[model samples]
Target: MARVIFLLVAVVSVFQALAAPLHSRAVTSPQCSQFNVYASAAIDEARLSLGSINTGNDIGNARNILQAQLSLLDANTGVTEIADSLLTSAPPAPANASATVVAGLQAALASLNQIFFLADNTTKAAVAAANASMITALDNAQQAVAANCQTTLN
Candidate 1:
């Protein structure tokens, strides 16, 4: 009877082990991660272009635009910090600014992720297209800032 009881307990433990949940860890920051990378690149490119100009006015405006770009990137970074916390911890609906940004970014990331989960192989291409759209938007915004800044400097 003792041996039979021990075998039953072992079987139950094995079954329980198989029932354990699996968790996937992801570490993506809206600021210092992939986001900052692209933003910074755009800024650098704009700044470099401004520097090649002959007029002081144009240079000044370009600088202002770059500054504005940096500000936007900073805001995104703030959001990332909030998101990082939520990812590692339980969902805090009452999160502060960081949390709020994280939630927003999380939503965006989810949208991007869904493109990957779609059954069609076209999903990845679609995701890439979406990403390109975002990059293009940023680029256009940056260009406007640079142009306006240059005008102000002039």
Candidate 2:
């Protein structure tokens, strides 16, 4: 009777465990989705400006555009400025943003920094090196966003 009761308790515990919900992924926040959209636009703009700079076509204009794009990803400038660039209205990123969201934004900011470095140099070799670094940073940012924000963005 003692052995039978022990086996029954074990079966009940296993059934309870099987019935529990799995939390495979974190629930992405709305702020993350907004930031993802804004970051994508900013990165696209920077890429276009970088290409123009690389081709030696209106370097000054390209630099200005690149700077403007970089500002959008800069958190120190204020979230309102970043949200203003969006065609649709979005609330500022929450202070308690998820780790995934913060990681994505940090990656974008690193790319922005790389672009800023690229903007200051016009030499072929310097520009080539900066461009390579900028591309890698941008790729990392994009991958970060795709990992969590793709399915959740508006």
Candidate 3:
């Protein structure tokens, strides 16, 4: 009877050890948490700037808003890096998830590059569309990270 009890205890200990990591990960994923915060802030800034740009404002005002958004997107690079690190450390089940995130980041950067070439109202409209595309790409990337990395957006 004592041998049986000892075996049971050992089995229970093994199970507990296996479960502990999952429980601890949420509390320990600081880089993912930081990434979420930075991503949210950058998204908020982009939204506000996009609002200003869409107000039928003067070209200069629109340009200024776009420039601000570009800066925000640029600043989000660090956060993206953190997200990348987390993903790399523990790749998602779907191996292509990291590639999706990369594609999104590239799309945002491409849109930003195109924005700087705006020369007329038509071009401004195109820039606006590109900005919208960038936001969608960034948001998609964030969602992918949250889903695959077990990240909580708070």
Candidate 4:
């Protein structure tokens, strides 16, 4: 009976040890958390700017907004790159999530690049269409990061 009890306690201890890391990994690292915050803010800004374009108000001002969002996207890419590097040594889940974030950022950047090239004389409908595409790309990036990284938007 003593040997059985000891074996049971040892097994329980092992299980607890195995479970701890899994639970802890659910919370992202500080770098990843920072990336989440920055990325979320960038996405929000992009959406707001795009909405302005869609509403046909301040079309000229929308260019400035897009430029600002472009800058934020560039900055976010740098932040996520750092997070990705740090996460490389982390567990597979976080590392994969970081990769997803990188891909998403790239997509958003590409979409923004296209939107930025729109001629100043472009029709409102055309501009609105482009804005919609950009918004979709941004939304996808946000969703991918939240789903893959287990990141909570602030």
State which candidate has the highest TM-score.
Answer: 4
Return the TM-score for each candidate structure.
0.28, 0.30, 0.33, 0.36
User: How many backbone overlaps does candidate 2 show?
Assistant: 0
The sequence of per-residue lDDT tens digits that candidate 3 reaches over residues 37-125 is 54545455454545545525445445555554555555355345545544455332233433444454554555455444445575466
Instruction: Give the TM-score comparing model 3 with the true structure, all chains together.
Output: 0.33
Better of 1 and 2 by TM-score: 2
- Overall lDDT per candidate, in order of appearance: 0.40, 0.44, 0.51, 0.51
Cα displacement (Å) at residue 24, model 3: 13
- Give the Cα error of residue 117 in candidate 3, in Å: 4.1
User: Cα RMSD (Å) between model 4 and the true structure?
Assistant: 11.0
lDDT of 2 by residue, 1-154 (tens): 9999999999999999999975432234565455545545544444454444443544544554355345434422332333332323343334322233344445444444444333344533434543454454445445444554332223
Question: In candidate 4, what are the lDDT values of residues 13-95, reduced to their tens digit?
Answer: 99998878432223455654665555556555554554455424446455654554564455455445445444454333333
What's the distance in Å from true for residue 69, model 1?
A: 1.6
**Compared with the true structure, what per-residue lDDT tens digits does model 1 show for residues 1-154?**
9999999999999999999975544433333233434543443443343233333333433343334334434435544443454456423212233333333333433334433233333433433444444354355334323332110000
Give the clashing pairs for model 3. none
Q: After superposing candidate 3, which stretches have Cα over 4 Å from the reference?
A: 1-28, 55-102, 116-148, 151-154
Q: What is the lDDT of candidate 4?
A: 0.51
